[model samples]
Target chain A: MSRTAIWYWAARAAFGWLILLAAQVIWLVADTAGVPLSVHVTGLVATAVVAAAHVTVMPQWRYRVHRWEATPAAVFTQSGWFRQEWRIAPVSRIQTVDSERGPLEQLFRLANVTVTTASAAGPIKVGGLDRDTAQRLVAELTANAQATAGDAT
Target chain B: MSGPGGGPLSGPAETGWRRLSPRMLLVHPVQEVVRAAPALLGLLVAGTSSGGKGHLWSAAGVGLTVLFGMLRWFTTTYRISPEQVQVRRGLLNRKVLTVPRDRVRTVDVTSHVLHRVLGLARVEVGTGTSDRRHDSRLKLDALSADEAARLRVELLHRSPAGQFPGTQAPAGQSPTAQSPTAQSPATSPVSPAAETELARMRPGWVRFGPFTMSGLVTVGVIGGFVSRLVSEGNIDLDRVGPVRETWRWFSAMSLALEIATVLLALMVFVGVASTLGYVLAYGNFRLTRHAEGTLHVTRGLLTRRATTIEERRLRGVEIDEPLLLRAVRGARLSAVTTGLRSKEGGQRGGSTLLPPAPRTEAVAVAGLVLSHTPGATGGPSPVTGPDTGPLTSPLTSPLTVPLIPHGPAALRRRFTRAFGVHAPILLALLLLWVLGEPPLWPWLTAAALLPVTALLAADRYRSLGHALTSGYLVTRWGSLVRRRVVLRCDGVIGWTVERSFFQRRAGLATLTATTAAGAQSYQVRDVDLAEALRLAAAGTPGLLDPFLEPAGSASQ
Candidate 1:
């Protein structure tokens, strides 16, 4: 994991807190319009505590557990914030690989790679990778998939 | 009898288009006209609002339906070739579909009351392969009954491929496998296996019905009535004549005794309903092996059903013993055959080869339908004992090996999960106490349930085990309704490895072996990561070898 990747996650947390702050403001306005003042006050306090924890600590916690590796035969993703899951899909099972980038990701020079397999586990998603690394990984997985295309159903 | 299209997969594409039954003109349009009646009424009402032209619009709707039906009947044509079955239809937008031969898994013929009256039947072809984009099941809704039966037999019949290895497969197979040409229904003799009765419903088995969620229906009915009464804000119980009379009669007894009487009455009522329902569904149940290499199950009293499964598609049998049934030493069996996808009203019942019977008989029939001789194989003397030998699925496992448990770490994980589940609820209770009024009874109940949860977790851990035998892999899982499945390793098409955060911390992973047959996928949960990989590698050799390093190193 790179130092730049930490900023990308912190930016996301910052965006989420901004929404929470907006919701608290709406609640305060509603309290002025005959809604109870206690509800607005208590909700604001709860939101403040949760938002502070999210922006300060949760990003580092997620970064610690978020691990992914690509072997010659399979791609393994061990990632989740609270309930971490390690998913394995063999290269022979890869159906399609998709690369996506948001405007925020473009600013950070990062991209996310999603590898689709036929297994019922859905798709293996790996985010917060350098754009060059993401492209190379995609090319490698595609090559591996094609080389063993006929082996799978 | 050769097919009307002559036995060509690609040739005669232009001239060999054969139409369905001519009766479709009367049958299809009547259905369409029935569907159009509601819209015609809407049109009639709309026309009346504008002017007096409602009747004219209604007539036009009927005419449109008739025209569409006639056009569909005229354009639709089907052809059966040697390698593929093709159907083409639609006048302006012509569409063609061709199903390959080897992909065809099951072909079933069903005739409703009307179809039977008209000598017509519906033929369904299932390929056992479904993609999210395309539904592979095909339904030819109208064909001559005889033609439908013939086509079903021909499509479902597969030449028995390789011998089943040991002496067991040799004793079980019909010698006719020597002649592959006999695959055709016309040439194959229908009298070889001679309908041996595999299983028939016993009247006493109906007693097991009440143990299976029947009491819940009674409770639901009573709950509905009570809620309706409360919502209506009723005051006069006497006005409800039946309740008033029952109350008057029970007034002579103590209050507790009166309540008990009512509960007893409800129990008897529910018991009778469940038993009667079971008898109606399974009274005349009969399973037989016919010479066509198919198992036929005919049952039901009011609505008789006859379901057939080709023996070649059968991967194995699964004997399910739910907790209550297990208490009485009873079990149920369902076929793990391909193409018996869980769809339609009666598919589950169709796949069930045996209902809730004594475990001894259930296992005996399982060995019978699976073509195994228990006494001859010496028996499960190693695992079960002499008398109850071949009593469970492991005996039928390709190598007949006992299961290997995932050791104590799995038990620890289960206990942790169980404790984690209870912690939040207990915390909420403490929060209630902080609110200055702790509910004592609910808190005490939750406390009492902790040991039960621990026990359930321990049992579940004990139930989790896997065995990789010669040709099959057997995995035992679940505590309440334990399933010991013997899935053929060669039938396994793929493998999936999953590890949760807690599992990863403990160096454990869940390995799932997916096959084309028998419950689709069987899992070996909470095994050491290295061991999981080795098991996957051993089950399906070189496929997983590339992904796994040699023993001692498995950080991935």
Candidate 2:
């Protein structure tokens, strides 16, 4: 995990909150809907307060919680702040390795690596890694996966 | 009967692409007609309103349907090659689906009333993928009953020479144990190999029907229809003669009597409906071991279903005891195999090894299935010598072995969660009453749920346990549907440990064993964090070792 992940998280949070705030603003401005002014003000206040708190606290908390490590045998990752998850996928069972970078991630030079297995329980995503690190991780995982035998199922 | 390389050898006539049973032509036209009934009716109405053109249009509609049915027969062709089973279809856009012989996991043969009447059956070849997409499976609809049966046998009997030497020895030796006279005519003439009847639906098992609650679905459908009719003002119960008289008589009774009468009627209705459903679905239920290393399940009344599961694809077995069924000591057994229909899929019941029967019987069947798993590498060796004899205690097999409880921390967590959710709701209701909603009685009534919730939480804790057998990871959980899942250790593909803030504070974690079979991921909920790590480490030996942060720091 990179230190710049904090900025990336903050940016992502801000972008999401902005969209929600915009929706709230539009709702408030729509006078034809006939919602009382007090309800609109209360909703806006609540949204702003929650958004501010989330934007400030979530990034630092997530940075502290998020962890990732890849070995020849398996890929291990710990993610999420409130509901943390530790995923371990054995190298033999890994079907595919992928690296993704969103617009915000690209700006912060951060990326996420996802390793999927035959299980529909979903892929293990190690997010908020330095771009190069994510690339290297994907390459290493792909190589190890290719070396293993069997149909992975 | 097998080819040079042990695969099903296709005859000269069978090697080339062949069309489905020509008898399908009869079925397809009728099916198409039924499918287009609504459209045909609309067309008929249009033609009638506009005067005699309706007849011509209706004729054209039926003709079009028949043509489409005929076109289907012309377009579709299948081939049974030594290496693959291929189905090439589609008119404008030709498509070919090839499934390797070795990859065939299950072969399901189904026939509805119409198909049965036509002496036809549908064969669906499952290629052992968890993917639920329709095209993922190779389905040949409306094959002659005999051809379907033979194809099913051929596809699954890849290793024809391989045999289970002592697997079902008891079952094979005991001729009196089986009542082959009861087998359906469709299955009786197919294979002459030694068949071992593992389990059969006893007549007394119908008593466990109501506990299954499948009849509730029927009741819901009826309720929905009635409600729709009432809402649409199509039928007025008060005006209807018999209904009006019944309502009058019902209303004449006292409130207590009315309630009791309604409850009694509902109970009786559910029992009768569920009993009927059970009889229809599992009337001739039989789980038998075919000599060709497959477990064949033949069941159903009106729509006879015969499912063939290659024993090698079977990963484990699940012994499900729903709350109601558990009360009556009834449990259902389902095979935890890959490539079968998912739980959400309509044909999900195809995986059932045994329907709701005695808990002891369910356990015994599970043992029989597990003990005979062919080529189970690194799995626990089968318990030799008459372990299945007179299962006085249901907990004799690894499937029913005692589990390691998640401990006091998990119990506390369960209580905390239960109280945390319920007490707040009670408080909220109190607050609502205080704020002048004027519902003191409702709040008082709801307060009664607090004790029930506490009891449920305790039971949930009691149910939360996991055990690692020599070859399986057994996990038990849930309150309403307590499932004891015994997953083969070799089937486990990955491990995931989850921790919420509350769990972190309590030093607890929920560990999930991810697999491609059954429900995909079975969790050991609210175990000690250190214990969860240890379990994960042991469950898949070298997979978690590289991730562990040294020996002493694993508790962290």
Per lDDT, the best of the predicted structures is: 2
Local error of candidate 2 at B432, Å?
4.4
Scored by TM against the true chain B, the candidates give 0.65, 0.81
Backbone-clash count (model 2):
1
- How does candidate 2 score on lDDT? 0.78
Docking class of 2: acceptable
Each candidate's clash count: 0, 1
| Candidate models: Cα lDDT each | 0.66, 0.78
What tens-digit string does per-residue lDDT give for candidate 1 at B239-281? 8899888778889899789889989977787777666666766
Give the per-residue lDDT digits (tens) of candidate 2, residues B100-182.
77677788899988888888889988876766567757999868787777677666653342233433231221122212221
Candidate 2: give the clashing pairs. Answer: B47-B54
Model 1 complex DockQ against the native? 0.13
Weakest 10 consecutive residues, lDDT, candidate 1 chain A? A144-153
Per-prediction TM-score to the true structure, in the order listed: 0.64, 0.81
